[model samples]
Target: MPLHKVVYLANNTKLYLWKITEDLEELYNEVKLKDSSISRLDGMKSESHKKGFLAVRKLLQHIDYNDFDLYYDVHGKPNLKPQACGIKEMHISISHSHGFSAIALSDKNIGIDIEILKEKILKIAPKFMNLSHLDNLTEEEKIKKATVIWGIKESIFKIKNETGISFPNHIFEEDFNFEDKKAFAKLKFNNKLEDFKVQFDSFEDYMFVCAFQN
Candidate 1:
């Protein structure tokens, strides 16, 4: 599998997904990485993680961008070179899980996260989300809903990229139906309150969430 999907979103946002079918060597040969990226790749301990990193570069190349056009802030957030993105205010957020890697590009503030649905999220649901939201749902529904809430919080945190933001204490998801495929969350951090619009979808056993500041 190559490019899995491209989601065009509101506010000039586009989310790209890549299914990682290539092995580490195949991926490594497919993309050109900068010196720093090369060093980082060399330091990775997992083959799957290395494949994910290279797959992201492959996604960039699919969009006519490359590793040279990508950089990271001191905070370790990925950024596109202004000249390469061809937009003054372009923003990007990236994530990977298991066999998938994803990136979201927007002219507005953005964050994205991809999660492999698992029963583990259910056991830890109380630690991050409101248990009331989990009521009235079957066991399967509980797992799906819990995964979405976790993704929502993760995405919001990625967008904010600030310190001391606790998922349980700082983020709250509004009530929503599983069929709605969208939700809202509030982040109360640093003595400031902020809202985010969340959109998500399930692909295979994986779920991805994208957040935009509202």
Candidate 2:
């Protein structure tokens, strides 16, 4: 199967998922042809990182790689400069787990995260789990709820394009049901509140969530 595919999630946002098929030599040569910078990176990391980078580079090509320069902020967020189209500035967030690499591209700030649903999620729940999330579920239900909540918080962090925000405590999630596959969040930061929409779905064995602020 082909490794690269694109989905239009919203008017301003697109999602790309890449599955690795080529060997390292082929991938290196392919990336080098598009951008010299990628050719310098070590491809021996994990398979996920290699696939993710290829997918991101392919997306960059679609947007005219030469006109815009790619650089990372101090916080590690990717930013793109003004392009020939005169469109709004573009922001991107990339997340990968297992064998899948997911990227979100949009004119506005965006964040996306994916995690395999596992029993281990229960063990880490307390660190970021809010009382409201716990109150709505039993022991067995908590694991899945916790996974979704974690994704929501991480997505918010990406949307804010900053760190140091509390996960489940300072940032609250409400008006969401896991079974219904949707959730809403109220993120409190710097004495102000912003609203977010979260959507969850199953892809292979992972639970994926995409969130953004308009």
Candidate 3:
């Protein structure tokens, strides 16, 4: 049938997400043929990995995947050839959950994340949330508030492309509300401040958030 959801953030940035439709076994077979790394399966784990990788490959073709040698760094982030397509730099992030996988690409640094809202987000809210943000929400509203906070943090994590930073506290989100369908965040790294705008949208059963610096 049709491919996954592809959202363009700008001329240089795009997001890809797959919504599964076909049988898992069939998809796994297709993925194995495309990438030999996926053919070693005899159990559930292999099947799951095959499906995810296939989804990733499907998304990759939607963008400029040619002339770019893809490799991963120590932290497992994908790197591209600098001079590919006359672009000096390329930044990308990948996320997948449930039956969906997503990739974000941009000329400058970018981070995109998707979350399926669930109740478990509430249990870990205190770890990443700040006092100011927590105080603004009532007890009954914690779960929804926590999910948005988690998404914002993930977006910032992708934007910063670094590790060892706290969310809401280190990466501060400024004035804009998801309820109003918009938000803005600022990340301070290496003594420089970078700003990003976050747009919240729903696709199927997922909550998608995209952040980028232009």
lDDT per model vs. reference: 0.91, 0.70, 0.65
Please, what are the lDDT tens digits per residue for candidate 3 over residues 127-200?
A: 77654665676664555555666777788786666766667557777644447756777777667787777766
Model 2, residue 85: distance off in Å is: 5.6
lDDT of 2 at 166: 82
Give the TM-scores of the predictions, in the order they appear: 0.97, 0.78, 0.75
In model 2, the number of clashes is 0
Error of 2 at 107 (Å): 2.5
Where is the poorest 10-residue window by lDDT in model 1? 80-89
Model 1 quality (TM-score) = 0.97
Deviation (Å) of 36 in candidate 1: 0.3
TM-score of 3: 0.75
Q: Write the per-residue lDDT of candidate 2 for residues 1-214, one digit (tens) a residue.
A: 2545566777888876765566655655554343434553553476666655664565456555631356567887766656632667777777877666677778767889978778888888777876466675777567677888889888888878656688865677884667898788888888888998877766666767788774
Off by over 4 Å in 1: none
Q: After superposition, how far is residue 98 of candidate 3 from its true place, in Å?
A: 1.0
Q: Count the backbone clashes (under 3 Å) in each candidate.
A: 0, 0, 0
Residue 128, model 1: Cα distance from true site in angstroms: 1.0
